[model samples]
Target: GAISYVSFGYINKSVQPISINGVQPTENNVKNNKWKIWSYEHIYTRGKPTGLTKKFLTYLKNDHIQTTLFNKLGYISV
Candidate 1:
């Protein structure tokens, strides 16, 4: 909610974020399987990605980019 408020006005205080079982929804917890309520996101390419497409994909998958940009933008990295 904090992240969303800062990024966009999409959070509703009346709607609380929930946990799965006893696990809280955190980055490390979710990544390590301590919590599990996520679905896989897929990107499809015709044939193979090349040139700018490949470069953009590589940049998106980079660790620093994932941590700084994607995470900050409320996107989960794969």
Candidate 2:
């Protein structure tokens, strides 16, 4: 099963930013798990908590939990 991805919006500050890219087709040149990418601006995930640190923390937790579960279940190549 594919885990739900949580988006984070606005941290540094920018205008007319591009939407964040979701899952990728190829894993080539990917830097992190599930193929993370950098975007000009971010949009908050559905039901994402609003705030400065809490939102960031929530996303981090979600990512950590998802990856940890995957790795534990032998989802990783290694």
Candidate 3:
């Protein structure tokens, strides 16, 4: 078997079977900085975001969307 580092979202969305050989991290692991692999999404703008960009940022910050990212997409909230 080979070891690979990937985001939880990738694993969750995978179409094929993935065998996890070791213990998976819990929320506590994230809080305590025990988990090493982290993924981030960033948006860069010349100035403050506005219009559709602002709306999109707001939408991503919504509680419901965050929950969905965790429950359905397997992404840990930061």
Which one is best on lDDT?
Answer: 1
TM-scores for candidates 1 onward, in order: 0.68, 0.19, 0.67
Clash totals for all candidate models: 0, 0, 0
Question: After superposition, which runs of candidate 1 have C-alpha atoms over 4 Å from their true positions?
Answer: 1-15
Stronger candidate by TM-score (1 vs 2)? 1
> Relative to the unseen true structure, what is the C-alpha lDDT of residue 45 in candidate 3, on a scale of 0 to 100?
79
In candidate 1, what are the lDDT values of residues 1-78, reduced to their tens digit? 332222112223654455557776666875797865555657888889999889988998999997788767666677
10 residues in a row with least lDDT, candidate 1: 2-11
lDDT of 3 by residue, 40-72 (tens): 756687799999999988888889988786557
lDDT of candidates 1 onward, in order: 0.65, 0.43, 0.64
Q: Each model's RMSD to truth, in Å?
A: 5.5, 14.3, 3.8
